[model samples]
Target: MNNSLDQESSRVNFYIRNWLLGILFIISVVGLVALIAPPNTNDSMGYHMPRVMHWIQNQSVRHFPTNYTAQLFLSPWSTFTILHFQILSGSDRFANLVQWFAMIGSIIGVSLIAKQLGANRYGQAFTSVFCATIPMGILQGSSTQNDYTVAFWLVCLVYYILLSLQDETGKHYVLPIGVSLALATFAKPTAYLYSFPFLLWLFIVKVKLLRWQIYQPALQLAMLVFAVNGFHWVRNFQVFRNPLGTSPDYIIYTNRAFSIPIVISNIIKNLALDISTPVPSVNRLLLNVISGIHELIGADINDPRTSSSNFQLNSLINQEDLAGNAIHLLLIFTAIAILGLSWKKKNFNYSLLNYILCIIAGFIVFCMLLAWTPFHTRLHLSLFVLSSAFVGAVLSKQWSLKVVNLVATILLISSLFWLFFNETRPLVANSNLLKTGRVENLFIKSRTYWYFVGRPYFRESMIGATKFIKSQQCTDIGISFNKLDIYEYPLWVLLNADTDKKYRIQHVAVKNVSEVKQNLEPFKRFNPCIIFDSSGIIFEKIPEQKGNYEQKWFLSPVSVLVKTKN
Candidate 1:
């Protein structure tokens, strides 16, 4: 009878462990699904992943074109964040898979952060659930957007930071912390500023500056991180002859305020429009209401209404996203309440809150500097992870720890609901979010070409474009797309997917369509057999009639030109 009881006891423990693992497994799946689903999140499809593809093809991690992916160059840290994507999976489909797993890494990292903060298993699990379920986190993670990865690295950084703080006399923690921050920066240029917090914490809580010796190791770690990440810079400088990978045209051209009033207003506006906490941007509210009215009066849900800029927008949900936001707000505020109540007494972990605040401040300020546009939650996803995890830790009060776990369970269930229903996607079979401007339209269509071929979100769509290049047997291919910003990543994917085959595909990079004449004069000199072209956006120096070329490749809004003379 004792033996039988032992077997039953062992079974119970095994069942419970598997059950918890099962729950986390489901949350991870939610993270992956969010990435592969709609909106392409960010103009990301046209950005970095394409660079990853290019690096793979070139057999070196460098900028293929400085002008082509200047923003990525500007945000130097992002290069290392997705470098693995170039190595393992150059296809849009594979990138999607990589993103999914990266998200899982993020979730795992989040769990570790909670654990290091002295939270128990229940606390760690709840925080991970919160990160996975919050509408904005889910929304951002669901796409191939960079913010999700940023959050992942940030969580890892914070966890290691906490671990470092707890370490009494070792400098080893410093290296890991610096490396994580360096990587976090690549995921978002804004992360370059996050270093302020870690340094502050190291000086204030850990090293205390009483000993000047730690500074040397710390400085060395920082330098190593920069040295490792500097290859992308070298590549960009070599190509663009400039160190920065990004452009400031959006802010420069907008004529929007960059002055004191504007900067302060931007910071206030960014915090005010917090999605996890229940506030919406003017665009989002107007969008939701308009989408609701359309749904009530016969418009399709998936292809909802576009921006009031006057096209239809894709409905990102079956409902207003307000309920999801409300629950998160309560959790956040309650967490804040707990933190405030326990600020002096909560001795669970190190008192590095001040330094974290410093980092958060730096990150927020940096984002504000770039704030000609409204702040979207996706851009702020990493902050949300930090804030939410702290709150989750607070709410996992000793007496109510079970309640915290229960609420997290419910959120996990909700995430599963969205995953299956994904009310955000079109009710019809295939759908996409359309961007503004003619060039953006062509970029969207070229992406749509990939979407129709089964790559789900914008990032995956890039991998789809790469697959397109791989299928083409010709090596000497030349392409002229209207806008570099929108197609930079796609170009990277196409060029990198197969570099060994020797397809001399030249992306005719010129400032304007007027420069297309100058850009193509060389191609004409070389006499390329086929030149791929895209046209929902116009990039023409001479009339189509004046160009002595035959159209050979058809991408619909895109085409290929066979040059008769070089």
Candidate 2:
């Protein structure tokens, strides 16, 4: 036993000494430190964390009245994990940790897939680091977003699928594959695109082989998926009469009908945006191409009607630094180069190649059938991960040692540079850390920096409004905003933390001050102590009665209407 333990320890030490492994360790430590900082992402503060808080308060996952349609309808598996951590810690200090851990899990799952695909230790290390260094992955991994969480589950499903294919007794692995698929689907609806094709292939192959025994395990798999994710769909059906809660046409509609040219144009634009970098010339060129394509398709690129569909492309042109996965184009080109060089090699695994092609084909079909959004790169995360494994395998076999080392060095440097000085606010600000001796002090200083220096007016308004709400000692508050569900995080966090179990806060959706006045009718019975508007709107009694309501400006733009009389 001692000899075996010593051998294992020595193996670990040997791997740690490798240059690539050392770089990976450094990068991971940086991610861990970033995870400790408070989550400040818009979606997280707006709905992700708030939804978890709501579930914890209710002590169940039942549907509730919410102005944020997404908060009530989106899959909650990722939030379930966040809820556990929030409940355990009694704070959101670890909210981003869930995504960070998912990043780590994805790395492990990618490494396993590379190994199964015939990559050596160095190749596996390269694959792990390559996936980890993606700018968007790191950014999302350090937030409360569900994309990375679902990506991790997708990687695991692929890994398990490969294992089951290799196993002589496939029945034993069906349960795990089923569980992984269920979890992946539950994490995000996009998982169906990533996992369903492979599942169908598995079933077809089994049928051809006349493996009737596998049917029982397949049924078990179905049962497991239904057990885990069925409730959410059932609830959606009950409430919206549509299992998905929103129709595909409603979600992805536009003035122009869906056509082949539009689909191709959208896919190209999505790819361009996904691989865009901080470089100005590249961004300008990509934006021009996208705009020109829109013109050819009879769509006015800048029209408000097209903004929602083209929002990502517009944002990319406006904010070039918002590029995702800086190495994506490089990864694709390298994979192509490697495959071309190895074309003469007679020992290629055609089965694996066919399977990967099917997965990619399914993803493209899924995207075409859904909407044309430039942010669809996030939906392509599983493809990126799978491509990394193939890239690793090809590099391990075709590339020379010197070439591999050079590529590793460049990737490591690029990853570190992005981690430290990328346009996106890093997890840890070096200047803040240098100024503060303790982590808590750094967090405080960082929050103040972000609130005052980074986002300035908007963040300050949120903080000021939260402080004012706490001071008012309101037992119940009603919040309304122009955007309906977003930018309510500050109030939710503060009000929930202030009272133990005696506060109720409800969100009312309204478009303008007139709508706000109209919506207050339903809440008047509850007599909300305060009505907070983050949209810079002011309210007065409709009849101009004195002393019925008092309005005060918490921030110049943010106002609170207090009810002094019923």
Candidate 3:
């Protein structure tokens, strides 16, 4: 009796010390990395940040009609629905700082998820730190974007639902999971992508747990998850006529074509395309066959762009951000090693939930986000985290063999050290604040996801010009570009928004030279009191005039014109 009591006490002490040290490390890294600003992602800068700013100013949720694809995140879309947290107080400094806490919080979430999923001490430690090391997670977490935010909640909700499923008595069951599901789905509509895997995992778990008759418990968990996540749906319906107003329709445009086989094949192919340099054997014949069945799921079923030939072959080998990639590669290896080493659990009951969790979670995520999933390491960060814990479990199980354990441990340590020691400089450098020239720099210098050639850019110059127009003490302000926040900042950030007229804005979509002319002629009619025109646009207003209007040119092809209606 004394021996048994001592064993229990020892276990308690071990957890206490482990938790304290692990938390300290998590806090330190998240704080240190938080110093940087969001890296350059045109879409993020153009829409997400601005959208949050608008929500802050308006204090209400509304659709963006002015934006061409304004309906995209129709219901509540902006950087995967971080609008909730971003809407908290609307302080730039605070939001930026939130980036730090969120990163650490994600590590905490990952650790908790691992433990709840039956991960042991080593499993928890490996999963938590490995999450920090992945280059994509580190890079995105360092930025102000919402992918990592979405990732954190996604993992947390899944873990919590499983916890609810743990009860044989159907306790606080569905309420917790329901609320969590609501939060997750609201965070990113992509959360719906998990439906298949989530439901699949539930069924699998139910089958396994039926010996204890946990059916009521499962039902309750499901109900609660639905309830918590239902608001997003309600609001989405109000705005877009759909519960989840923001997603593929506005972005992917599957109406033109849908291919199940291509989606399935590319689901696997894209994984390789995202991680490796060499194009794994082109399943050209398969793609051709899948093309016929696009509606069902095809092979060449490229979703981002309409054509399969659009793949940027040159970029596959040109991953320039050495530090980021080094971190990416090292983290991937460590996760694999950890999984390899932790693969064993003497008791199957303790391991069942996590096993089903990994399989279901991994499948849903890969499938739903498949076509839109980035082809770079940073884009694949969430997968790395999910895969790592499973990897850790596998590693632990396999490590029972003496030689295998040593080898796995050494590889894991080496990859981790390489990530932390060698590549720390790039990701955490100067907050990567999405400055003017940094977009191109990130492309040429850093092997980050931003290097992709087609991404958009927004500059402080645009904001500066907007301020100049607003300060003229004019009646109404008009702009020719789509980015409202680009010009709305200095005034909104510096001036009083209660002035009734924050500023009226307009923009034209320029597809070609002809569209450019058609876009400017209307601006001439509105005669934006002070025309903000760029040199690139066709305008009669003096490009260098000191007269009634200001012609502002930003990015390369796009410019804003402000002129009076008089």
Candidate 4:
């Protein structure tokens, strides 16, 4: 009993000595508050939540016709969590908690990997905090994005791989590695790019260590991965004649194949966008360089034709808050500097260093080759989270525990402040200050409490339009839009809220006015009581419908054309 008391006293002293613990606690509390809030991000409203709702309504995971190819083809692992949570909670209020838990799992996974890599407790704590402090991770963690979920699974895969390597018995660890890989892949197709090399490394290690017996576990791992993820592929193959669905064609048609120099230039531009502050001279230099590279590649940076992709890039760079990429850049540069200084030192672990280098190189090459988004930084979440282990390892070797604690404390506090003031302040600034109150009232008072409830797109027009549709008591609705998937969720949620019999919502793809006119013929037979036109498709009443329809326009540029003589 006396020894136990001494141990407890020591633990308390350790935390007091390391103020970073207190800082991490504070940041975690803020993240939890944000997670409990409702999800309202455009992507979440557009398809993520909608897809989950569809699965719940159907009571099974099967193909449904959707104008948005992603709703039909994207892997359902992440949405599965949302569906389960919504079912358990009996509401969508807990949707963001899935990603929040994923974030926490990622932090724990990083720490476990650091430990496996021979980091001390201080080093492990530092690495975990480092990952948590990334701006993209925090924002996505508090929202409903699959990137963090995939990152969590990838980190778990690494931790299990390391565990399997160290386990001489090796019976229990192989299955976990397989399960983690499957979960990661099913969560996001990009997981294949991020994880294939690591899986290959694991195979080589198993063969070197276990020889012929390795085949049994290896086969088991393969079977597990295939078993968990095969349904999605098989479904796609049956429907689309390709297991990957239309993504390959979409990629080929939508993105230009750039030369190596152009790709490199774009990467640097993305990096600058991610990390660089809003200094005028720095912005000017970055713009000039980006423009010069575009010119060299025979692409016009300002061409309206290419502006959609460019706008995505600009929005990610400009709209995201002040944390940007500074923390990531600093961690990377510091790791490199520490690696160089320690090269001649006797304690360097060459095997671990080689593995880390492989991961970094593989991720960079993958991004250069296939990642075309302006929001490419988000795609690198797994890469950065895994790399935090190396940064912690290096910092542990070079710096004292006290110094490491100080640095981590400073970073955590700064990141927490930026998250509160810059990223989420708009959501909570005019609220009742997060006081003790009922969850429902807190949600009601906080404008930014829910992304869909608080955001301009949903609040300004989508809600009103949904209400108007409900008031009209329309049973059949036809939705035609350029990108219907992103705007389909709100309508789905509002229309189906209290119904035992589902409302029939049909989607028609409309790229231009001619397509809309041509498509109206088929929809006429369905005789949808109303048509929601979002693509500016209904410039005038359809020739077939002459004087039967009247249009009601919303601020979203969405029109609810009710059939007056149906």
Candidate 5:
């Protein structure tokens, strides 16, 4: 019996080692891609990187007048991370790696959370593998998006909260819990919805922790959150009249109606989003079923009041914004079903159950408040990441060693497709090496080549405009984009704004809600010798300026307005 027990322990150790090795390999590959790729996701191009550029240009994180109000008001913690790196490095070269580091941290953090739920070495390491392989996590792990960063902080928050609940000797976790809360809150608004239930669960579990001897930690937590978010909140209130910055953009994304039917419709659609697959027929079938359920409940499938965007079952692309974790979703459902059906046979684990309950509540809260957008899979990243811990704990208890290994293998195999072929920043199909036959293809210097690989027309327009401005020896350039989601960061990059301090780009014609602040210095005093207008709005002269700024060149969607003294 003693010999057999030793062998069993040795086997588990070997499996743990293997799992850890697989996780490291995945991380290394994704980290390489993250380091190689330029930040070019639609949202990154639209506002994420653009906001960082503005903050760098202005030397402050204050609200700025522009067509994209999101760049002004969205949480700044993620950009804060980017800004720190950019300022220290003197370029945006390290931007994508921010999310990459978050991915690594989240993987490790979830394993700790798993251990707190009574998982042994094998189970804890398994949690790391599970997180490392999430399709959405893998896709966003290599981009400049905040989802993974917020997910990392939330993972730390959940782990620290559990530690505080379980700790009997001292209050070491209090500081970390507070810090994680502050960081997560400052990272994204979705953190509020996701963190609420877990915090409530912690309070319910230990109400005495709020008393005199321990109340200091709670107060510290509150102070930390306030300290991290206070300045930004004040700025938002001063500009938008709401600390949360409730603009028409946010209002439209919020569900306009509140009813059980709308909630149910949202819940179903949101869950279905995670299970979306690459097969068009299967996606259509899923859509039909979702639509049928909505009809039965007397709700519109594509209700503008309920959906933030046109509802579509898209599964063709493996985009960071749209990739869903179908394999992990199936694994989670299987674990839940097994645990529910067999709980009577197994010992009751209240901690795991409470954790799962809180996650479920978080999901319901998310569906209740926010309108369904196709990119919601990205928003659901935290919930998916938290679910990884639950899946690890439950599966470790229910499945045998062989079955656990099989599941892990399946997850790792399925994730490789996304890891190599991410739609925006691919490692394989990009073929940058063969085309250039140089090391630059996989480095920061080759960013422009990789950034413009697919969007040739947009690339041509931006590059052409930048070259034209340089030829005319213009330093102060004006830019106008009609849409809020236009690509503006590439212009700054192409013009060498980071390296050359001579280039100064400003919003030429401001007409958005953010324009209320245009009376301020930069907006008021920005005069340009030339303008790049992607808005396609032709004008005889620059707005609010008197001159013969005739349209000299038209390049597809972009037009050049050169100022001429008459």
Candidate 6:
């Protein structure tokens, strides 16, 4: 019996050692990709890093005139961290690390949550491996996107809530809960939806233990929240007359109405995102079933009122912005079914069961309140992260070692494609790296590389445009872009705006909801000798003169550099 017990211990240690090595390899690859790739993501180029640049230029986080109102209005906790890193490093070299660190933190946080849920050492190892292999998490982990960051904070919040419940001493976790909640709230709007039910659960648990000591902790919680978000809230109120900064974009992503049919429609459409397969026929069949369900419920699947845009079920994608976690979702459903079948058992842990139910409630709240967009899969990161604890707890009990190892192996295998073949930042290309430059200068130095990979011409066009601007000896340049979705960061990098203090790049002739709000700032006298336009149409007016722009150089039809003439 003693020999058998020792052998069992040795086997568990060996399995855990192998699992840890696998997780290490997975994160190392993801981190290597992140270190090699620049911030070339759509949202990062369009608004995320652009806003950081604007704040750096203005030396404040105040609202500025811009075509993309999202830069001004989106909750900015993640970018706030990015801005500090950029300033510290004196470059955007560390931009993607913000999400990479979040990815790491999320893995550690989930493992802790699993332990709290009664998972053994092997179970905790499995939890870390599972989280590290989530396709969407792996893809976003290497980008400057905030889905992973927000998911990290939410995981911290859930873990602390679990700790507070299990702690006999009350109010010990109040500060962590407060800090995590504030950060998550300011990270993204989706954090609110994903965090609602768990927060409610915390509140209910805390209220049952109400006492005189709770008041101080409660006050500490409020003050901590305000300390984190108060300045941004004041700025929003000053600009938008609403502390929330509910821009038109926000309304489009929000559900316009609350009805049973709308809720059911949203739930189905949102779930279908994860259920999607790479096969076109499978996608069509799934889409048809969703449409049929919507029709039966007397709701339109593509209702503009509740849809961000035209809705289509996406196929398997390696892109961070739209990748589906089909394998993980399947595992979650399997774990749920397993839990349900054994829920009546005498030895089951009800605490872990209740926690899983709260996360499900959060998902239900999300579907009921938010519109169905193809990118909702990325927003579902928090839900997926929280479910790892459940999966860990279920697999830790009764399941044989072979079954658990098999699931972990499957996840790691499925994750390889995403690791190597990311849509924008592929690691196995002909050149093997996205940027074209020296080995040390791949991410550190600028080249005529693809800032937007899909638009290959953007590289040469932006380089040529910047050279033209330099030749004209213009320090004060004006940017007038027609669309909000255009890439603006390449312009900054190409011009060496970070190192050269003489360059003053400002948005001129801005006409948007933010135009009137930009008035709050004392206007600077900006008269550009040259204006850059992405639309190929120059501005008709400058500061004082009825300035007409003559096309000086054209690198591409879309990238036009024009000189202002009175």
Indicate which candidate wins on TM-score: 5
Cα shift from native, residue 217, model 5 (Å): 4.6
Q: Candidate order by TM-score, highest to lowest?
A: 5, 6, 2, 4, 1, 3
Runs of candidate 3 with Cα error greater than 4 angstroms are 1-30, 36-40, 68-90, 97-99, 169-172, 203-235, 246-261, 277-309, 313-365, 368-379, 400-464, 467-471, 482-560
lDDT of predicted model 6: 0.79
* Candidate lDDT (C-alpha), each: 0.51, 0.64, 0.46, 0.66, 0.82, 0.79
Model 4, span 455-512: residue lDDT tens: 4455546666766877776777777654533566767766666665457676644332
| TM-score list, all predictions | 0.70, 0.83, 0.65, 0.82, 0.93, 0.92
Candidate 2 per-residue lDDT, tens place, 279-373, comes to: 56767787887778877776555443322354444333211124455465576567766666656678876544655565667666654555555
Stretches off by above 4 angstroms in model 1 are 1-22, 25-44, 71-92, 139-143, 170-172, 238-242, 248-264, 276-326, 342-363, 372-375, 421-475, 484-502, 512-527, 535-546, 550-556
lDDT of 5 by residue, 1-566 (tens): 99999998998998888888888888988888887788888888888998998888888787888766788778888889999999999787799898999999999999999999988788887888899999889888888999999999999999989988888874547778889999998999999999999988877666665555456666878999999999999988887888888755534778989999989999998988888887889998989888889889998878888897767777744777777887888888887887678767657787887898899999999999998988899998998899889999889977898889888888888788887777667776533444565433344345685665445568877878777777776788888876643788888888885345477777767765677777897667877888888887635223445445878777878988888876
Off-target runs (Cα >4 Å) in candidate 4 are 1-20, 23-27, 169-172, 210-215, 248-259, 278-281, 289-308, 311-323, 422-458, 496-504, 509-527, 538-556, 564-566
Candidate 2 or 5, higher lDDT?
A: 5
Q: Per the 3 Å backbone cut-off, how many clashing residue pairs does candidate 5 have?
A: 0
Residue range 1-566, candidate 6, lDDT tens digits: 99999998898898888888888888998899888778888889888998998899889888887766778888898899999998998788889998999999999999999999999998998999889999889989889999999999999988998999889865468879999988988888777777788877767777778855557767887898789888888877776777777655534767888889888888888888887776778889988887888888999888988898776866547777778888888888888888889979989788877888998898889988787788888888888988988898788775887789888888878788888777767775422243463232234334336465645667777777887787666787777665634678878887874345467676766666677744565435665667777764444424443345566777664444455544
Model 2 TM? 0.83
Per-residue error (Å), model 5, residue 177: 1.5
Q: Which residue pairs show collisions in model 2?
A: none
Tell me how far the alpha carbon of residue 531 in candidate 4 is from the true structure, in angstroms, after superposition: 2.3
Query: Per lDDT, what order, best first?
Result: 5, 6, 4, 2, 1, 3
**What TM-score does prediction 3 earn?**
0.65
For model 5 the local lDDT of residue 284 reads 89
lDDT tens readout by residue for model 3, 277-393:
323344344334445555454244454443323433222222223113433345445545554444574544445445545554555455534343333344445555555555444
In terms of lDDT, the best-performing candidate is 5
